[model samples]
Target chain A: MKELLEKIFENIYSNGLSEERYCDIKEFISEKLISEYNDYVMNREIVAKNKVNTLDIVLPNAKVGDYYSQLLKIEDEEIIEYWIEGLKKTGLEVVSEIVLDFQKEDNTMVQGSANLEVFDNDNIECQKQVIGTKNKGLVIKGNPIMSGDFDLTLKYKYKGWFDGCNILERKLRFAINPDPRSLWKDIPTDKNIKFYKDDFVSEYVTVLANDKGLQKDIVAASKRGRSHAHEGKARDDDFKLYHNDENGWYIIAVADGAGSAKYSRKGSEIACETSVEYCKQALQMPTELEETILELSKAEEGYSNRSISTLIYNIIGGAAHKAHRAILDVVKANEDQVRDYATTLLLAICKKFDFGWFVASFWVGDGAMCIYDKERQYIKLLGTPDGGEYAGQTRFLTMPEIFTPESIMSRLKYSIEEDFSALILMTDGVSDPFFETDANLNKVEKWNELWENINKEVDLTDDNSESKNQLLNWLDFWSAGNHDDRTIAILY
Target chain B: MRRLPVYLLIDTSGSMRGEPIESVKVGIESMISTLRQDPYALETVNISIITYDRDVKIIFPLTPLDELQLPDIVTPDSGPTHTGAALEKLCSQVEKEVKLSTPEQKGDWMPLLFIMTDGHPSDIMIYNQVIKKVKQHNFASIIACAAGMKAKVEPLKQLTNEVYSLDTMDSSSFKKFFKWVSDLIEVGNKSIGATDELLLPTPPEEMNRII
Candidate 1:
């Protein structure tokens, strides 16, 4: 202890060091190898599987879209070997390694030594390898046709619902009633094109919602997002602006891409828009599984049969339908137009009445959903597995044909809370995160893995607005949240 | 003398914008400086800072009188209040960090966590699990505060014993809060008292209290 103090005294007396630099040295030197490996257990994943390059490191049973991996910390070389043995017991190739290091100062007595893991990849990248970062966001890559890209973004603020985790707003839109110019490149001029309402609706609402997220209003747009040099993506995904008594409430959406779809963005937008519209229509009077699913799916399918294969799972109750086809090889009416066009969907129906607020949801498929209750300690689960494959190393969701659930009921409820602010809807792209894989575990251990100790993370931010933005960016495998084409929508 | 491990859980969540955020950042530096100045506190108080803005980021793990350094944290623009996520992480982190400390290596007393949140969790519901983990470990006695956010105090009550609310967000209140926090640390270090004494500002008397 005296020697340690003497070294500190010398550094204090030294003329060539700043306190910040000194602190960094201590952090770099002291964090050791073991804890870092433990941290690796909560992150890592494969976001997009667009068939970009063949050398994409596909795990034995890994898929191209929506995969996750976690790293578990092991000490004794023998115990680690045994853990790997346990994994092999499951009859799968579990890749893992450990990193060791010793700390020293001025070549004196050793303080301690540590053995930790460098990195880990498992379960077809079904979970993000656990890691820590200075900035907030997930690290993931996907190929969305014509664009072979890797997405590295943070998940800022979010409103966790049964349907989807909504990313908070981050920009200015001058979203007023205006006219449209050239938004989409190849839109034939004569084919029912009206940009004015879309422009005005998008513009006015965005600005008003922007003000609502101001610092004075409890939450605000990310300062980094508004920085002059910032040219971050202006996502038109899962966003809508509504007004009440001259105040604006923006509704955002988060949708996951289907593993078997050629074009997921189209499915994502359709699911979000149609779900939001359905809830709006049902607001006057609520109905049931027969009306909500059969009728709603019919309505969406009626609109040119383009959305027939899309799963319409809503959280404000009334969410129904079969899980997928489960590799059984049976085509429905929706497949007549698009060959095996299917998507995993989850929806949230939120309505803030005089009695706190009420939101319910229903879901199916190998997706996920979470709800932060009024007490903050209670998180409700949504989008449980609907029986494609849920055992051993055999995970599901690679193709819509793998979905199969016959008798379906409503996995929905209503909450009586006055502080309600938002609703969220997402595709498997957003929901795939909850079903993660780790070095010590797999999808079969979902309940045992999260078991109380998993959701806890120390967020330093005091305002949720900033937190929301970070959540949006962090939902990837690398950033923080489960890796996927994370779309977060917050209604305030 | 009583040993107190003062864990500072700062909300680096992006919502804490501008000078207020800056002031909290500076306040962390000040807390370290002030704690270092007090010989008793310096000897007995162990400090660690866990910053969570977007992700549950641990700026530094728990360090004792032997190896301690005030970190250089770059304040980001935004972060998600994965408060529950952070807590869940801290549960494991604290357990791992504690395992590193033996009766001969560090103090044997339990750690104390001061969770300062200006808002609620961006990702909901999962915090229940986090809170349950924290309570299960009994690793630290939590002191939660709703700093600048129109925070959901009801939720804060579910996690800790001492939950305070700050009136009108500002730098002064933060400084004072830290001052009171440091004072408690000083007192706790100087004496063997189990309960630390903190001169905290009171919330509006009329505010409805949950716990």
Candidate 2:
């Protein structure tokens, strides 16, 4: 088109009909051509702008307290390269420097504390960038300080066919997810707060007594759950571990207080203390029950020994009844309702006999008691969890119905093994996360996983000097939606 | 991971066409922001929105709190409030979405339900019929909010004992109500395993606990 216009001008100049007329013809054709050229370039710019708008620019979502980075891309290449290539095909060029800026609409970025940085330098820019060879596209990197929807506007500038620059704006949206762990705040329970109980009652207790044949080493750690700690609420779980050196018996009692109960912390404390103390006294040496247990241990595997069942009942079942009566005594003394002191009780008593080991448990609520033998790949659940029709519902020792002879006998579980790995008892806080269901408590693989996890945190080897703190740390493991006061006792 | 499923039943009838509906949208946005700040709710809470008008629709399916994108909630020029249909949808969603504990997997926490309306149910017969089904789901808590003067509390009582009233539908009033709702959610998340009825947090001044 330029050549044709040049040729016409030359023709007019050579003919020289009249100097003024020649000049007038040249001016008219030149003006018309310039307008047409401008119109064509404007049309091309519109098409290119439309294509730029259609570019798929997706930014990956970020997480709170996590460093995030994603390369700015249009198609596959860097934004600048993709834009320049797309414009070149449309007979246009980016003649001027390309600049990128994020136009903020609100305080979203301020709350997020994020920054856009050059990919290569990793230097934070104030949401603005000058695009060049060294800086192809943006690298949004930061440890997002908060979680929320962040709206961003990216303003791009580049010189077009005209001398002026063309500006394009793109809106981007992304959300920062809150870190589940960061949200949990561990506020120590206030001892002087309302309904306050003894802090040491539910805090933690560990024992290592090597007097028995198997060298019993036990660790019982109870920690306030994330939920309880979040609100400065007292721990509602308790445990008591005792080793009768003279009698050669190891007894463990764990209890979970009903969260809805007001004085459940005290209830759990009394339950654990009373149950273990009762068993400690009942399992004394030179007692009739000991001789019966010894004889039962020597009996055949299939022998249905009625005397042993009755004796085990009088020992373990009697402990559950004693715990219940203790809770009732507290209720009576304090002029409180039994429901206010609702708690679940799980008691395990084990003694090494000449024949093997006799392990018996009395469970009166939701929790778990198991005899786990990792080498033998064997797991025996002491009793079925007393889960109600709904998820959080479980019978409590404070409830009178659970003290019936039939109910107590039904809740009693005992086993005789030549050798075993560990006798473990836990509250629902631990069982709900580790075993999950009653059936899983019987699965050897699940027990193995639990054992491996425990070993990872608390070494169950020769020396358990650091096992207390390690076991307490292990109780802090995060399980989504399972935050409750955790209590676990392992006799290995 | 056990999710704490939360269902929001909103009324989008003709009466909520203008400022009321806009206030509701703002209220919901504020609620999401508040819940995001809570660590327990952020980890376990999953939200679903069910809107009822001349027609009932599930505007948003059950989505994790962090991944939720607030959808545009619009009301018709005029329409009937079919809360019964919304309840029916909720029942189906609960059955299809809320997991039950099994040996293989830990089930989701009992779901929570919140219903907001500015008028009585247009389909009363269906409402009565489905109320029993809704109760059968054994939600962790079912709270009903009667918004504005036109809302009848008696109808809400049939659905849940936890009925609240908002005197106005202004942005501030809705904001306060929703803020209280977030507190309720936080409390629910903290007390997930409690067998007793969920104890509600004290409501803001703009809202009143009717029951």
Candidate 3:
């Protein structure tokens, strides 16, 4: 030890006694002295009888916002009282005093004087003292306010140790788990930022053609997604709901623009407006379609009528084709490529006939259109979502291949129901969360759940005046990892 | 919940024994911290790590961003870089972990793969054979990076079209590269329904994208 000290002193002197050298010397001297003192205390016969090397204090883990209490167990019997320090910030407190019973070496149980003293009492919330005198243990109890792994350096002052070595320091490591719901952050979007489009769109159009027995309440809403809002981008979804009171027909169109395309917002707007306008003009003189539908509805359940399909195709499918051509026309007028105007379109034209409610729809992409019946527990999906091999790949209206006759024919769906609870059309933003898979859209239970969730926020029983605002508020439902522009049109 | 699976393939051969391996660890830690702050990434991202030396070891399995714990990575004193074996193990893990969309269930998003190495593969023949198998998985994006001056670009070029190179294996360079990676992940999460190919974010000045 003397040789090592001399070598250290020589090195420090050669280093001119700088701050680093002084710290090194001080650390070396303290370590040497502590080891020498420990060795001397260990060799004595009297000290050997009271030598306590290890103190095992087991601490239980905790979680935020939970009332945590655990009995701390220390193995040594000679420790009469433990004065624990350095727990100022932690939300924990120890009971003042308790009597402990420990077995002696002779196997005889004896009462021992034991107590736990905590210095800081600034954040104590527990009032009960340590209970059970005979078999008492040190209890640390409080409600933790934060979540993290805490390494506590506990200074324990106990009896029955070597001279000048009564103070023992131990490290207690425990973790506090965070509340799962607290991790999600809802940062509101800046409305007046750059690249802001006119996103204030909420329509409540009531179609009341009493002579024709067509009484429908229509509400449509479109909102920017959290992802686009986070980046201060514009809402890329658009919807147009037109009720032709003259012919008792409801033309509802919803479109979702591609997120990566710069001009997709314009594409979606044109798609919805052009499709609803075209369908409105085509169905203005629908005497031929009305007769074809009446004949088709009178046929057998499994009958496939060519004239009805042709009429529905001319109305619904032609609307989609016109919307595609309109988007291409706009792209050409603006000197842009077709990809810049990529968008998905879902067009539905429904009318209440003498036979039943006839609904015809044209779907081109990943969104969903369904006729949901709550009383009968039935759901009919208009068309299958065009999900690609990957998650995000979907066919767009701007694509030339989607304009093919076979493609358009396959997308056309017509259904004649006696009545439906609701006719809902949604973009991928709403469909991806409510009905995750294409098959889920057909599941009656999924539609029930969606209706239940919507009814919780919006009163669907009566035609309430606040249904439009309630529907807009319901659009803000939180779905993790699903943040995209949302557009939905409901005819109930 | 639809997870966005991400696989990180790291080279831990003998040449990465000192500061290079330590810097890599720091780079990954930085990346994890950055990703945790993004709400979209925190909700959807799941990460897996594979290390290759004389043997390939999966240090971390597919774990969510919220629950991920990066383990300690060690390198041998001297060993060959079996990049082929690492790719083979990755193929099996992807098959077991990545879910494909079916009629009944919604699957995870197309996975993203990132490979970093400092030298040529010792098992070249196996690497060539496994390249086609890796492509069959149809990953959303596959980025291969040759780190440090001694790294060979030719070997990494055969693996992916999106190849990059780092001039040095320092902490700052790795940090910049990982920051860019986090940005790429954020962009990928939002723009999944693009009809065209996904656009990649620009790299930092410390890293160069090899065309």
Candidate 4:
């Protein structure tokens, strides 16, 4: 530990800080270290305090008032209360009138009068409520504090669900949502935690669900289809969906892992996640300048949308390279299992434009990407799959050739158009069952019929969550004895 | 999405009755168990076993690894090694079972054939006929393993270029051969629908290459 700290200090000193700035450096170091230490300690405390129920609250896997009655048990905890207090400090808007409720084991209510308030500066704004034992709703006195810590105090006695007569006093503390935008910037180095989505989704679910600029609805899902031999093993296909509402951009990446690879599933997962992350970064690039460059370049060339398309193609291509590098990182870290992580990648990025949308897709394997226009009622195939010069062979992203910009550009396909309806990106597992070959992918009737079937089978008009679940279930639709792992990502 | 068909033909003549037979049994079992652990093999490989002593026996037909149960090999007390009968059975089975690709459906991948023996075959003419049939079509790949000293490579060479001569028919050699088989199946499973030829591993250091 000492050696590590000495190395860090040595590196900092090597940055050429003079003795005259010693006081300023000391203050900066103190503030930075204190903040980091606090964050580390606070995160640990929060995990330790609500280890059992934190995942439930953070993920909210269950819905209230559904066919199944959801059980929510808030325990007496210090961090939850302290974190509530921290949120008020961030000065974000918070809804007033926080409520608390107690319920019995068998969905029975316990009637009692309970008071909730935000005691800021000793000003107690008490919102009184009659808490029913069976259930109660507490509306916190403000909109969710976007970023920061906040504290809350709960004084309540509930009859034990198991014991029936013993009264239990509970207090809870919870930190408000942290800045979700950081998730795009901080790529996890740990392999096991790199693909974890609980925290990321909990923080950004609202932003992802927000369809402010999107002209239509988007539905996406993935599933492990039936295995020809093993009943329980997953098919080697994975996908990712990423959307940045503020940036008005969404990315869908799907990878079909090489069945020959022992850890192809891991490769597919890392590929999708890393590619989406890179695309998120690409979305931040100055596109206006790119457009200006394209416009000037277009004057020298023909009237084709080649320049703009090239820009979009390059962005998507660059993201694919980043994903390839991430996979290589995994391979290099564990050379013994180098071939285990081979997989094919397909990435598509779409951003809303004034007329329609600017869309680009890049692929280096056998999968299908289709763009369906609701207005024109036409379906377009983005590009052909890289089926190798053999009957059953295709290239994997792990191959070194795709790492170069030239090769990536050669593989990319793009479009800048109006009347954009929906984008369908899928691994071969799902695509194979639907369309046996790439030649059948662009059949307008088939695409339209598929959408019609989906509309009939799934409730897409009401809730996006329901549609997502339905799509996931739809992936399990078996046909032609083609049992493989299936993954599909849709943007509409 | 097509299944990769794998056929294993083992010689269970009187010569392989002792420790060699037991080793072969253990090896086959271990290979299946290992293949079951791989997600790719479990999902794609459909294996079949054909054992020949005096008479060929189809112990098990093409069955997926998930539902397949490795059967016990019972070699006859005294019988000539009829490898030709086993090859004939395999040829007939492939013709009967392997589906040809059609407009409506994709057929199974080219079959992977592994022929293992401890002695020379009694009926060489039939074996030559089966080899001719296999050569006419694109069988994924074929491997012939000559196990005991009595096993001749010249007879096996007529069947495949990928022929190996095990120095001794001991338990270790049998184990190494089966381990190679398991690894080869895994490679074959991964390459299914993605590559034309089976991507088999190099023979273990103990085994000798037979031209």
For candidate 2, the iRMS in Å is: 2.6
DockQ values for all predictions? 0.01, 0.43, 0.45, 0.06
lDDT tens per residue, model 1, A208-301: 2233333111111111111001112122123322323222212222333332233332343454455445455444343442233333333432
Tens-digit lDDT track for model 3 on A103-185? 34222444353333342334536622332121344667788777665666544434445456645555666555454345554
Identify the candidate with maximal lDDT. Answer: 3
Error of 3 at A7 (Å): 32
What is the Å distance of residue A104 in model 4 from its true position?
81
Candidate 1 vs 2: which has more lDDT: 2
- DockQ for candidate 4, C-alpha atoms: 0.06
**TM-score per candidate, chains pooled:** 0.29, 0.80, 0.79, 0.52
Q: How well is each residue in A36-84 modelled by candidate 4, as lDDT tens digits? A: 9779765654454445333333211111112212223344442222112
Query: Which ranges in model 1 have alpha carbons more than 4 Å from their true place?
Result: A1-492, B1-3, B65-68, B99-107, B190-211
Q: What is the lDDT of residue A257 in candidate 3?
A: 90
Task: TM-score for candidate 1, please give it.
Answer: 0.29
In model 4 chain A, the worst 10-residue window by lDDT is A197-206
Top candidate, metric TM-score: 2
Error of 3 at A103 (Å): 13
